[model samples]
Target chain A: MQFSGDILIEDEFLRDGLQNEERIFTLAEKLEFLAALEAAGLRRIQVGSFVHPKWVPQMADTDALCEAMPRNEGVTYTALVLNGAGLDRALAVGLGHLSISISASETHSRKNTNRSVDEGRAAITPVIERALSEGVTVRAGIQSALGCGFEGRIDPARVIAIAREFAALGVQEINIADTAGLANPVQVFDLCRKLQDAIGPDVALSLHLHDTRGLGLANMLAGLQAGVRIFDAAMGGLGGCPFVPEATGNVATEDLAFACEEMGLATGIDWQKLRAPVARAEALLGRALPARQSHVPSPPWLREVA
Target chain B: MQFSGDILIEDEFLRDGLQNEERIFTLAEKLEFLAALEAAGLRRIQVGSFVHPKWVPQMADTDALCEAMPRNEGVTYTALVLNGAGLDRALAVGLGHLSISISASETHSRKNTNRSVDEGRAAITPVIERALSEGVTVRAGIQSALGCGFEGRIDPARVIAIAREFAALGVQEINIADTAGLANPVQVFDLCRKLQDAIGPDVALSLHLHDTRGLGLANMLAGLQAGVRIFDAAMGGLGGCPFVPEATGNVATEDLAFACEEMGLATGIDWQKLRAPVARAEALLGRALPARQSHVPSPPWLREVA
Candidate 1:
């Protein structure tokens, strides 16, 4: 009863999990996985990215995956687009939910997207405009929003500025990404509070996190106390960036669900359906992932384990 | 600047880490590991438990470990005990710092120590007397203190009764343990606040946590905000209760230290130096021990890789 609110979970297993693979899934495999997500009641999913396949062959079937994903009345399917060009492709597919990312650290923005923070800002402007005109939802993700492995420390003001810019550009949501998992709870609480005060809830906030330094959930908890309701997670903790060395995986969906339920926060997720996705993911990856789902006898574990 | 006070790190790698082992470490290895902990600037450690070896064979050598541990000027070494017999062994070894535990739930207490809640209470009285007479620093650990895996939920009043008991015993400290990892942050903060209000800080409070569900550090952060300090952690994410099947490891010491340091809290521990003990543990286990150390750098791969 202490946590009196509902939390939303969005799955990124397909898009993020693909990054850690050696071979791209065939169209059939991608469709099978997408269908599995739908059957499992994984409502909102970032199914794939619209970047060039030459650079990220792992997401080669972005277009096909988008077209093949089963639709549900209550579900929202999303795709990641780092720039205007990718947004164009996503728009062509009639995407209503879109995510655009720019690392808060100037160095990461340049290396990952070949743009400085300012240039990244300029690039995302058109995408935000298109989304508003097309009546689509845009969420600007400040990558490496918490800490920069390469930089040692990240300026929280830089992230706040980026959130402010996206808010001005009509972005409906803001995601603070711990791209390298360098954030602790205090930093998370402080930074989330700053973003919350700046945006005043005009832009809904979510966190796309990594378990790199193992404070992923701690950071999320801090964000939750700051009024964050949406979270991005992967099943079986499967997902990491192939381009980024040492990128482990996204915070596991099952683990986050467990924490929320125990806190009396409602996530509207049936964790039993998630286990099959985890098993399927491990089979696809040909190995177990980093973080395992908790073995507690919560509703999900009861259904899955028993 | 917002976070007040020094960050204290108490390593339980020797005591708790040994719980999850398929094959326990040799006494020589434990001694070597203790030396490594001191070298890492760890000023306090829960070295071993004085419980009956029949219950936890991994800790049968508690006496040998205490006798062999290299004593230091500022370092404080503590041992976990159950009753007078264990206290006698600790006193014989000249250990001033000691921990006694009883599960908050009657069911778990019965299974954990083969004694009912009231029965467990009756047994520890003589143990407390001996420790107080010897001028020992005593910490009464109340386990399953938050929520239980066996029992559905725990009442805060039960915990209050235990705290009142410890206070009456003239014990110096109380450690609230989420033995089954059932706590969420809100529950943690509320419970700690209630416990502190019921029993003033006559007994300095600490937390011993298990990450069975990945909310270990989150719960600890909540306790800190509630004005509770002192905690226990094992190295390399190793821990479990032999009696509690499939219980996960304790919060990893290196990971906890890194989290506190990142939060700008001072935990008087050199995480970089803490690596040696973990390495020894991994080598002996012949499998990678899951922890945050060497897992991933902060964020912004752009800088670290550059």
Candidate 2:
């Protein structure tokens, strides 16, 4: 299997990374992370989500954070929006890119969004249409596309069907998420390949993976082999599945970049520059994160190999 | 990229896992761990290394541990030996399987074993010969075969040449080690394929990987794609390279087994049974280990996926 020549990394540290944590980052701290991410040459970043403060207290200041964020050239700053109200909030902040996602598992949809699978899809349709009519970049996402903690073994056919609907709605990208970290390499490769075939390459495919079972990077490697070039990662691996107790975070941004760069794929990410932010995050959390690359010194062979 | 249907796992938690930690396990605790491992269906285990206590104090009781270890049916117990003296000690205990290894990097060889590459090879030749004459199963190892901390970018040809020498010595297996955690997936696949071609199918190949940079399992996936079926892992991801500060441990045995089992490969090991021992190790170490599988609950999809 041939790998892509370059990879696109979208860091979701402020959003997914912090949403599940008990200690919330203030607006100032979020901006600090944003500046560091931009300076480190990360082209895509998810600032926060526009969910209700009552539901997700950590994301209460997404609008203020987005308004305060600098608009760097060549960098696309996005936020997650789950409904029309969240879309209105994101658009009010003049955000160009927005992620609107629904869960494939009916049980997960009900638990996460208080809507059944059909209800969730119906609710997001108008949000996507409104975003598209306003010329906003829409990244349609399918959560629990690989598997779910509540409803195990989400069918690939269901995921592809959801993608087909999102494609017909004229979205620019489709992101398949292994929300519960239940995906293996073979399942990832198979589902990704089938999705690519069904989507016919018009809509870009990206993956949002979690590292709960220690197969996150391995599954990412399989996704790469299946022709996926874009991935969502979090700094310091700081995220967990709120639905699954003790589930780990997304793949670490530095670790993902290191793996890609080591395999001759240009990620345009400076892993060395990520250390300060990761260290700050660790200090603030008063605990160590699950990230490996940020903690260890760069090996001497990376320069020679990459 | 065809994976082998059956995989072999050699757990080295007792040796590589504990050697670098400050805490030491008594003979009784080690026996408990050994019993747990045997009950968990581990076929091959590396109990400890026959090194001088002055260097690795944690392994000071290896001889006594070996003598007291029960000879379970269908289980192959082994220990590491660095020279003729270590070999003699291992022989004195009647260890059926012994691992004799050298470093591929000249600088690492000098630092780790206090000998040049040639001298290290010359010193181990008689040990290998003696072990062969005693009808012991010899697993010849090449450390820093992928890259080194002291001297970076070890040539794959050098690793192949060493494997050839080991094969000529009539060793049963050749284990390639990424001593400094500098190996990438492409490098691992290419080197393992070349080593397989050079050493032929008669000599088995196993990989000893570290998760220092978080590429261990990904590299293991690449090795599997390259047709390697045997791997060395530590429970609770307990091993670290003594030469590299802040370097992490080996790939977790449960994590590796979970991945293999998820990918339709039979590992003949029960990952669930490993939790008790891993928890014990964590408690004894007074810290959380780098293992993901032992911390998280088994996903409901594993039963359906596998």
Model 1 error, position A206 (Å): 1.8
Pairs with steric clashes in candidate 2? none
Q: What lDDT tens digits, residue by residue, belong to model 2 across residues B1-306? A: 235478889999999998888888899999999999888889999999998899889999999999999998899999999998899899999999998999998988887799998898888888999999999999999998998876778988888988999999999999999878888898999999999999999999999998888888899999999888999999899997576554468999999998998888998998888888898888888988889888877787554533
Q: Work out candidate 2's RMSD over C-alphas.
A: 2.1
lDDT: worst 10-residue window of model 1 chain B: B297-306
Model 2, A65: alpha-carbon shift in Å? 1.4
Q: In candidate 1, how many Å is residue A121 off?
A: 1.5
Best by DockQ: 2
Which tens-of-lDDT digit does each residue in B5-83 have in candidate 1?
7766778888878855769789998888888888877888889898888878889998988877778899999988888
Q: What lDDT does each candidate get?
A: 0.79, 0.89
Model 2 in CAPRI terms: which quality?
A: medium
